[model samples]
Target: MSTELTRNFSIIAHIDHGKTTLSDRLLEFTSTISDRQKQDQLLDAMDLEREKGITIKSHPVAMKYKAKDGKTYNLNLLDTPGHVDFSYEVARSLAACEGAILMIDAAQGVEAQTMANLHLALDQNLLIIPVLNKIDLPAADVDKCKQQLEDILAIPAEDAIPASAKNGIGIEDILEAVVARVPAPVENPDKLLRATVFDSIYDAFRGVVSYVRVFSGSIRKGQRIKLFATGKTYEVKECGVFTPKMTKRDELVAGDVGYFIANMKTADEAKIGDTVTDSTHPCPEALPGYKEIQPMVFSGIYPVDSSDYEALKMAMGKLQINDAAFTFSSESSTALGFGFRCGFLGLLHMEIIQERLRREFNMDVISTYPSVIYQVTKTNGEEEIVDNPTMLPEQQVIQEIREPMVRIFIMIPGDYIGDIMALVMEKRGEVTHTETIDDMRIMLTAELPLAEILIDFNDRMKSMTRGYGSMDYEHCGYRPAKMVKMDIMIASEPVEAFSTIVHRDKAEGYGRALAIRLKDVIPQQLFVVAIQACIGGKIIASERISAMRKNVTAKCYGGDISRKRKLLEKQKKGKEKMKAFGKVNIPQDAFIKVLKSGD
Candidate 1:
């Protein structure tokens, strides 16, 4: 097909706003899939995504839609994830398209992520097609949704299309609007090949298969391609487009979105956002690549059994190929043994990885508490980035500690604004701005320490607002605070696995709570064990596990009282010796009991 008859666009939205559902409807409407082949969320390939009702990866498909003007257009549709953690996926998809369908729930109105995605689409200068999905429900107020669109996003209310992806309403109107509004690609095909790699996957038998959006020239089988990022060259063995599946295409011209298999032995070479050009006549400049992912959350992942360490290593390697944001390195702890310190974009990303490890690779694993990177400035004018609490230096060496801060936007029902504001203050967050969306809803912008909201802050907000709250955030910067590293010690020895960095003001109460939870799980030995939560040399909180008594005087009831006293005294001396020299064995179950995340 010619470039003039081709349209490239993506469906972007907030979580569960029906991006995937809309994709399914479009694919079916265009006959991209047969009646028997059609199913819900057909674009969501992962089992975890289907089970969770979330889109973890962006899916690309090609369709042939005959418009009302009686012209068949080749449409490249990209369906992007909506959750904040997967915003990176949306950005990647947007880079390859000329337009986006901004999806919003009709009953819910504009949400935090909806605004976040809208800003991303505007940044790319793409044409936006506002869509109010799920309009069939009784609660969906078309007038209110359209008004919110004009008020918050500044998009004209008349342009917003009201449709239900579930019942297939306005499917033809959406397709017709897409063909009329979205512009065709204009890159020259005669120029040297410069294909931008939006995504790629590791195929066991086929090696690395790259998904590319051709910018100039064309790519085909038997062509030699040069990867701009790694400066590696390979001969393309096959090329194909996704009719939702890999169907062979003789050649992919400029403006085409397709996958090509090269002899890329390792996943490291075919990086996403890489520019591919002809090896014999390479493009002078590589296309601008996506910014590198800076992990917002960090945690330690260990195999349940020590012998599965190598297997876990292989599993992580496989996962890293598909997800560029996830990162890990070799680490060890006294309680958990050998493990990898993994970095994730957010809590959801972390959970998805753990789920994938269990379901896909069958790698049973345990993870320690999640943490964020901290900036530590020393007294001698040196600075260090610490993710793990055990890497924190001694109290005497640190000058000031800075923690990551995020600017969070929370939208909730207006009636609970006071209660939600109180919860924010409880988490050491300050409300910066508040705007009423309408008579019923309000949006609150706040600055919060990343660590403070890492665990249960979202849960609390939802409960307080009666499940009418939604939140999205972006990292603003770091701010200096009175931060300290607290350690859990058993019998005077600190366990590296249970160490955490916390605010100084909350250390007392937080430490006491942790110590109490630990006391319940750690088994009692022959000698009394002291569990202490310590900040440097001073203990903030402490708990003790009583020793199990043997009752040595049970067999000497008729003996003299001195005999019983001597036995008791001997036992006490033995217990004292044990307490002084005994090495405490923290059970695996104890680590699981204490370290499992609240999510």
Candidate 2:
């Protein structure tokens, strides 16, 4: 088939808006997957995605659709993730296509992420087809959704196709619109060998299997290809397209979306967003590569058993090859021993990575509380970025500490404005602006410290709005604040893992909460255990775990009262000596329990 007959596009949407379901319906309608092979989220190959009902990685498949125009066109459909943490996946998918299907839930109307994704698509200048999904449900208001599209997105209401991905309604209409509205890939006249690598995965047998879109040339078996980024060359062991499964093919020409096995042992050799060109006939210039993605949330990941440290390292290396947004470095903790300081795009991304390590590699790992990056300026005219609380300098050495800030757009029903305002204020966030999205809905723009919203802010917003709130945010640089490093001490000894950077105003409250939580989780010792939260020399909050007293007077019931008193006196003397010299053994389970609990 010629390049003009190929249509490469992606389905982009918010979480749980039926993006995967629509992909399934399209695959079924096109007869791409057989009856026996049919399943929900067919493109979602990961076990995590199936259990969570969300797309984590971008899935690409090729379909030969016979349209009403009496022509069979090749459709390359990339099913992308909807969650905000995985937005990078959607961006990578969008780079491989010329068009996008913007999916929205009819009952929920437009959302914060919906607009975020739309701007991403627009940035790439891709043709977008607005879609109103789940139209068959009783609560689905198609008219309201279309109006939201028109007013907010600026897309004409009539352009959006209304259908239920669950019931397979209007599948043909969507395909027809994609065929008519989406432009085909234009090939370079010189026909130089060039391709864009959208994603890559590691396989024990196949080496690195890269998912690529042929832009101006072709790739075939035994062809020598070079990665522009690394300047490394590899022999293409195999080249094939996905029918939801890799199928052998003779050659992949221009405008083709498929995988190529290049016998490259590691993912570093073939990086995501790298340009691929033939070794023999390279293109004059490489395609403009994607912008680098930086992680916003940081945490420490350590194995429950110290012996599994090396195994955990190997698992992290393998996992990092598949995830570009995850980062890790070797670090030692006084409390957890040796571990890796890991960085993630958000809390969900960190959680998913931990879950994958446990399930896929069978490594028992524990993660500390999540934190955001901080900018610290020292008294000697030096500046540094610190992701961990342990890396923060002393109060006298640090001239000022600046926290990462984000501009957030929250969409919610009109009734919850006051609640949202209070929640934002509590998090040390300021509402910059507000706009009425519709009669029943409003959008609030706020600037907040990234660390304040890392854990339960989203959950709280949803609860306050009766499940009608959504938020999307972007980094707005750093701002100077009165920040201090609060440490949690057990028996007057500092535990590095439990330390955090907090605002001066809320230091007492946060410290009290953490100290109380620690007291509940930490086991009692023979000596009294003092769980204290301290800011340098001063302790902001403290909790005491009373000593476990032994019954020394039980055997002297028939003896004189003075004799019983003598026994008690000796017991008290022993307790005092123990408190002076005994070491408090803090259980490993205590750290795990406290770290796992949310704020």
**Counted clashes in each candidate structure:** 0, 0
RMSD to the true structure for each prediction, in A, is 1.2, 1.6
Cα deviation at 540, candidate 1, in Å, is 0.8
Strongest candidate by TM-score: 1
TM-score of 1: 0.98
Model 1: per-residue Cα lDDT over 1-599, one tens digit each: 88899999999888889888899999999999999999898999999999999999888999999998999999999889988889998998999999999998998989999999999999889999999999999999889989999999999999988899999998899998899999998885458998999988778788778899998899989999999889989999999899998999999998899999988866588788899999999989988888887899999999989999999998887787788889999999878889999999999899999999999899989998899999999999999999999999999999999999999999999999999999999999999999989989999999999998888888899899888899999999999999999998888988888888999999999899899998899998998898999999999899999999999998896967999999999999999999888978888988888888323
Assess each prediction's global lDDT (C-alpha) against the native.
0.91, 0.91
**Residue 569 CA displacement from its true place in model 2, Å:** 4.2
lDDT for each residue of candidate 2 in 1-599, tens digit (9 for 90 to 100): 99989999999988999999999999999999999999988888889999999899998999999988899999999999988889899999999999999999999999999999999999999999998999999999998898899899999999999889999998888999999999999999999988999898888778778999999989999999898999988899999999989998989999999999987876578688999999998998998888897999999999999999999998887787788888899998878999999999998899899999999999999998889999999999999999999999999999999999999999999999999999999999999999999999999999999998899899899899998899999999999999999998888789988999989999999899889988898878877888889999999898999999888888875957999899989988998898888877778998898888843
Q: In model 2, which runs have C-alpha deviations exceeding 4 angstroms?
A: 554-569
